[model samples]
Target: MLTLTENASTIVKTLAAQAPGSDDTGLRISSTNEEHTAFSVGVADAPEPMDLVVESEGARVFLEPGAAVALDDKVLDATLDDRGSVSFAIGLAE
Candidate 1:
């Protein structure tokens, strides 16, 4: 199932507040390129549904449809020991 960590929720809340006239917002993560590889983030009034968790700087992230197929049942994690890095392990589908 998709999960958002405390830090991730904070980031999302902060970004949502930054949008003009947007009182409610969620991370709009989507896949890009025909390679079906790569993702991007932006503030949106709505966040696509998914069942994955992405960890970055102690924050958890959720993916939208465009990114779900590639990320389905994936456990993503990120760290900042020296530089920023994101890694993941694929999980079996339910």
Candidate 2:
């Protein structure tokens, strides 16, 4: 299963709270290709059929089946750069 770091959960929760109608919204992760190498993240009001729901730090995440398979055992982390930009990092779980 895909996991979110403390920072990632915090960032996602903050973003969701700022969006309109976010009470039911979750960060959705999906792949654009069959290979599942290319992925995108966005706020979704609900999970698609067969999607996996992951919850951490009060934040919800919906993972498409393909993305779930590709990201299994991986950790998603959020970081703020010196330039005041936020970015996400994915890697093997520690």
Candidate 3:
């Protein structure tokens, strides 16, 4: 299963809370194209029928089947850059 670092969880929770219909919104991850060579992440109202739900620190993330498989045993991390912009990094679990 995919796991979120503390910072990642906090960021996700904050984003979700600010979204409209926050109660039903979660972070959704999926392929950017049919080839699955890239990915896209955004807030969604709900999970798809076969999506995998991963929760941590009050945040929820819905991963498409293929994304879930690709992220298995991976860790989701967040970092702030010099410009104060936040970004995410995905890596194998230690």
Candidate 2 structure quality by residue, lDDT tens digits, 1-94: 8899999999888777877774778888998899998889987887888999999989888999999999989998988779967687789987
lDDT of each: 0.51, 0.87, 0.87
Candidate 3 backbone overlaps, count? 0
- Across 10-78, the per-residue lDDT of candidate 1 in tens digits comes to 555555566774433445567776554787766566444563345444333556665767665544332
| Model 3 agreement with the true structure over 1-94: per-residue lDDT tens digits | 9999999998888888878884868889897766664778998988999999999989999999888888888898988779977788898899
- Residue 61 CA displacement from its true place in model 2, Å: 0.8
What ranges in model 1 sit over 4 Å off? Answer: 47-62, 75-94
Candidate 2 has a TM-score of 0.88
Ranking by lDDT: 3, 2, 1
* Order of candidate numbers by TM-score, starting with the best: 2, 3, 1
Q: TM-score per candidate, in order?
A: 0.52, 0.88, 0.87
